[model samples]
Target: MAESKDLLQVLWSGADVLRGKMDANEYKTYLLGLIFYKYLSDSYLAKVYDLLNDETPDDLQEAQKQYEEVMKTEDAKDLLQELRESMHYTLEPDMTYVSILNDAKGNSFNREKLQAAFNRIQESDELFNGLFADVDLYSNRLGTGDQKQSATIAEVIKVLDGADLIHAKGDVLGNAYEYLIGQFASETGKKAGEFYTPHGPAQILCRIAMTGQENKRGLQVYDPCMGSGSLMLSCRNYSTEPDYIKYYGQELMPSTYNLARMNMFLHRVHPENQHLRNGDTLDADWPTDEETEFDVVTMNPPYSAKWSAAEGFKQDERFMDYGGKLAPKSKADYAFLLHGFYHLKQTGTMAIVLPHGVLFRGAAEGTIRETLLKNGSIYAVIGLPANMFYNTSIPTCIVVLKKHREGRDVLFIDASNLYEKEKKQNVMNEEHIDKVLELYNNRKSVDKLAYLASYEDIKANDFNLNIPRYVDTSEEEDEVDIKALTNSIKETNKAIKESNTALVDMLNNLTFSSSETETAINEFIEILKEV
Candidate 1:
């Protein structure tokens, strides 16, 4: 764990070199894009070395010489082809990070070389197309002129080159990349909502979505609002066959969409298994001709961004089933929800993060909530603490939904106060996450903390699915003793009287030669009597 922290620190230090050159949001593109490039290059070289070892088993020195020689000749074509089939991308010998660093050390490196490398990478596969588009090599943010821009990028490359990315375990490098994204999220404040979800709640969603699928293979996990692909990747934690899980996601922002693609590759997820798209998930429907239903769907979309909510949408398949009313045009919370729920397989489970208003808001939202509850679509609601997310402190909840649940009971977990305060945000430790998961998996009620509400119970409340209504977490007030309080007041008054009498005596014992002194002592005695 300590080593991981150290590695993260080293990787993040590269960002520090660019701190003054650009904003955290912009500089993150350069830093993360370069790190991802380095990873791809290192990964390619590692595969080459492994293959070389297989060819020359006895002599390590001979293998090194042969590896360099073959990479320069047409003989390396077969190896590159095999790598393309497996890794889905290839890096030329001169395009590697090592070559860039060596040239930078000789003061011969420039932004044009990096630009060429990025162009070649994007051309290598459809997965990498426009992957580095956000990392503008010649942007003025780096510097005003070509010399300044080249120097800054060169310095960044030199710093990243110091880190041992090639030999480190895949998780170690992937984790470092995630750490940088989180740091950027913290610095970006509310804008972080566009591209990042805090790790704790993400874990809860993944675990809830993966319940009963522990032994399942070729599991399909998806996130419609996949910000940097963190939640989509979190599903790997619950599955024994992490590599077999196919990842699918969509992001609205072009830059964030690119980030999600880079995130997938950095984690070593195969290109064929990743189906990420860049567009408005609500404005345009995706996976249109492919298998629309997914085994697990997770989302942390914008809280209440406005959408068309047009009358035309009433005919749309996703919202049409939930009565004629659509989520208010002013708030599209339900629109995002219904979109994700539409893609959920009948046997699949979905977990989505939403604001508290969705639980009790009336009008169109209320009707949608009622429709879902009556059909047994909603499963559980877990209330998270305030300030738990980087985007907002409005206190959010994760609603777990199943298409056709056997039972009509909805589990409500009031974990609003179950968090530790950090410098700028509230955080849920592993213990807190596990407790919620345990209570959720148990599917039974725990006093105050959790409640299992039957459909009849919800009907009595007019279908208000607010968590506090179902699971009360308020503390019980201490009972007051009237007799004990009266006795105590009398005892306190008795002491005051006794002390006043003594003070009066002391005042009388003082000699008063002047008329003024005598008048003051008389006043003091009267005041003591009143006390």
Candidate 2:
């Protein structure tokens, strides 16, 4: 805990320096990318140290030579091996974070040199060619004045250098990185919400997807919109089952795509076991020569982004197989849903976070919604409260899909009313998450909160997956007691009259005129009406 605490402090210091130096929008990429790089470098060094423990490699040259030779013969080019030789990064003699920081204190840290180092690191591994594609190290956004950028870079380095981030004592580095991402989301306004998903909501998504799987044997997992890999990582954090858990994901944003990959590496998820990608998932370049399938799929794709419903897509296997047309160009939410549904295995389960519009939207989205619901595999539709995200406060829902179900009804949970309020955000805590998961697992009706909607019932509602359409989310007005209410109103009127009389007596004692008093009372009443 102490080590973790120390690391957090260093991270906060680094963030403070970075905030002072760079623009709010760009700091996330630079700082998070650096932390990820540090993780990779440290992990690589640790592997090298362990290999040289019993038999000293004499020097770095011998170490590098042996590592390459051993890697060539191995059946699987392990992550550790790939790190040493990959084109994503080039490790110079003294260029790790610690080494550069040491040198910077003596002389002005060469900004070009640091940038070059970063380039070399990324270039060292071709697989990560555009990993840091979003970061513009030389961008003027940092500052037009050269002096300010240099100072900002230096401060960032100084703060990170002093931070004890190399050790995986806890999730200190990961949490700090997430915190910085959240800060960036807050500062960037609307555009920021696209890349950042708050950790709290992500937790609920994870819990919902993995609810009953804790008891199940093998629970393979995946995410289609793997922003920062936070949702997938949450599974790794909360899961009790050991060997059954595996993670896969894809992301569209280049820089965020890199961060997700780096996050997986930090969490020690091996490259061979991971299926992360940086591309448009809707077009479908899944990581397999054959049809690949997953057991658990979770995603929060860009809400209603436009895309070419390519004329050819009508014939593409994923959508055509369902005998349904691709969602219209106006909304891409159903496109992602179709992609997720196509990738799901026959015996698998999936949960996806989508905007509320998907529920009742007409045209192509409605057509696709009807198809998914009529399949009889739709398990649950959970409505989340508004303002649960980093920037946008719009309400959202998680659609749970499963190929195999023990019952014929779909469960609808109206969690729109259950949330813990923060200053500007609404969070779903452990209790809230647990209750949702419990209802999902139990598959029971909870009065007006959760209900099992029949296939016929849903079909009757015109296939609208909205919570209010199924779970009866209306508060019912608490069955107002007419007699009690009337008594309360009378008492309130009497108290107000008495207070007015007392005020009149006070004014009369000061020798005020009746007309003047009436005018004053009228003015006070007018003011109070607005208040």
* Total clashing pairs for each candidate: 0, 13
- Candidates in order, TM-scores: namely 0.93, 0.80
lDDT tens string, model 1, 75-171? 7899888878876777676776767777888899867777888888899888888989988887899998988888899899988866766556667
Q: Which residue window of length 10 is worst by lDDT in model 1?
A: 55-64
Backbone clash total, candidate 1: 0
Against the true structure, candidate 1 reaches a TM-score of: 0.93
Candidate 2, residues 18-105: lDDT per residue as tens digits?
Answer: 6755566667777777676666555454455455465433343344444445546653246445556542344653555545565667
Judge candidate 2 against the unseen true structure and give its global Cα lDDT, from 0 to 1: 0.70
Q: How many backbone clashes can be found in candidate 2?
A: 13
